[model samples]
Structure formats: structure tokens, C-alpha cells
Target: DAGITQSPRHKVTETGTPVTLRCHQTENHRYMYWYRQDPGHGLRLIHYSYGVKDTDKGEVSDGYSVSRSKTEDFLLTLESATSSQTSVYFCAIRQGIGQPQHFGDGTRLSIL
Candidate 1:
């Protein structure tokens, strides 16, 4: 499991609402990432953090934002929920870019 944890294993919300997901890692890695899983497109990165308070946007970052205030904790927030954004969100952590990333169980979000 690589000591990674994700909260609210599942969630359901109405469109236009705000949602936040949390990821925690006990590995103390420098790199943390958030990704969304859809049926056909596989997994796509949403945001990532390289270190404490150091984060960057990923390919699909338009409606999503992320924060990492400490090495073990990373957060993902959806500013406005939408049906298009409803998917299984995953959190991963790695010691470095070249290293393998270990993923958390994931949080399944549904927008109604």
C-alpha cells in the first residue's frame, strides 16, 4: 500500500457543488500526485506536488486544484462539481519522478 490513504471512499453530490478529497502518505515521499480514472481514457493526472507547499497542475487541471502543506498530506479540491468531473480519483506517491508510484484505494465521486 506504500502507506498511502484516501478519504471518503465514495461520494455523491449534485452538480455545481464543491468537493474536496484528501490523500495521506506515511512514506514521506517528495512527490505526490492526484489522478482521475475513467472507463475509456484510463487514468489522467489532475495535479501533483513535488514537496511541501510545492505543487503544479496536470493535464486536466481546469476545474481542479491541489495543495500539499506537508510531506505526508495532499489535498484535491473540485471548485465546482460537474458530471464530467465525476470519476474515481486516485492518489499516488513516489520518492522521486523516476521511481514507481504507489496508489491509494481511490475515491469514487458521482455528480447528479
Candidate 2:
């Protein structure tokens, strides 16, 4: 999957806390995206970056933030963790438009 890796594959945290998930890639893709996968909602985009320091909000970005300081790393942070925010987060990287994205396994987060 183009050497994509998500850190802390599993995480359990309490409500009202802050949590951060990391996605790192070795392929030097110019576009990266963060998505949350829930049982019924399917994959919902949270945020995305087109290039270094250039990011935008997505469909489900209410409580989440993302940063891409370098070509190989993207960070997704939950401002304040909540039960509804618990889900499997996936990171995707694409070389450019019209190309297929390679995804990391995912980060399973639980909020109690």
C-alpha cells in the first residue's frame, strides 16, 4: 500500500480527552486524506491535504483537525474525544487526481 502506516493501531481513551492519530507514508504522495469508517455511515472524509501545510475540512470534520507538515506524514487530532468519535480511522495517499489511493490499515479508537 505504498508503505503507509498508521500509529497506535488500537487506542482506548476516555471522553472529553484529546487524541491524535498519525499516518506516515514512504511514497511521497502529494495528496493525503483522513477518513472515519463506522458501521452504517461507511467511510466519511474528515480532512485532507493537497500539499505541505495546505489542508481543508471534509464531510465529517466537526471535531477533528489535520496537519501535513511534510510530504510523508499526516496527523489527525480530535479536539475533544467523545463516544461518537470512536471509529476506525483510515489514511489514504494518492499521487494526483484520477489516481487510486493507497490506504493504511486503520486506527481503531474507542472512547469511553
Candidate 3:
């Protein structure tokens, strides 16, 4: 089983507010992923890291950014969150792309 934790399980913020969500892993996995889930849209990748200090943008990376200074932690930041960004954000990690992913409880971010 994969062990992960996402902070601020739920949040309410105003439009244009700055927000940061954190993902922590205890398994010391090499690949970490950030995704946002919305109704009908399914899950869309935002950013991912292959290793510490080596991160890459994913399909839906716009309006979002990511950082990984340590192997066990990955951070996703919204410089200016808008209502369009409101959704459930999930964090995942794995050994490889084809490998199974373990997910966090998710952060329900709402921008009003």
C-alpha cells in the first residue's frame, strides 16, 4: 500500500486569493503527481515530479505551479486562485507511470 497525506482537506477562499496545498509521502517514492478532479472532467494532471528538484508540468498545468525540495514532500501553489480553479485536488505517487498510484484524501478548494 502507498502512504500519502494532503493538507487542508477542505478550504474556502476568495477569488484571486493565494493558496498552497501540500502532499506528503511516507513511502519515499520517486514519482509524485498532482491532479484536479471535477465532475464530468475526470482527473487531470497538473504537475509531477520524478525526483527531488526535478519536476515537470502536466496536461492541465496552467494557473498552477509545483515544487519539490525534498523526496517526501511536494507542494502545489496557486499564485492567484479563481473560481475556475475550485475543485478537489488529489496527490498521488508511484514508482512509474504504468504502476498503480496511491491517492490522498484530497483537498476540496472552493474559490468564491
Estimate the TM-score of every prediction.
0.96, 0.97, 0.95
Q: What residue pairs clash in candidate 1, if any at all?
A: none
lDDT for each residue of candidate 2 in 20-89, tens digit (9 for 90 to 100) = 9999999988999999999999999999999999999999999999988899999999989999998999
Candidate lDDT scores, in order, read: 0.93, 0.95, 0.95
Ranking by TM-score: 2, 1, 3
lDDT of 3 by residue, 19-66 (tens): 999999999899999999999999999999999999999999999999
For model 3, give the 10-residue run with minimal summed lDDT: 95-104
The candidate that achieves the highest TM-score relative to the unseen native structure = 2
TM match of model 3 to true structure: 0.95
User: Which residue pairs overlap in candidate 3's backbone?
Assistant: none
Give the local distance difference test score of model 1.
0.93
The residue-by-residue lDDT of candidate 1 on 1-112, one tens digit each, is 5999899899999999999999989898999999999999899999999899999999899999888888889999998999999899999999986799899999999999
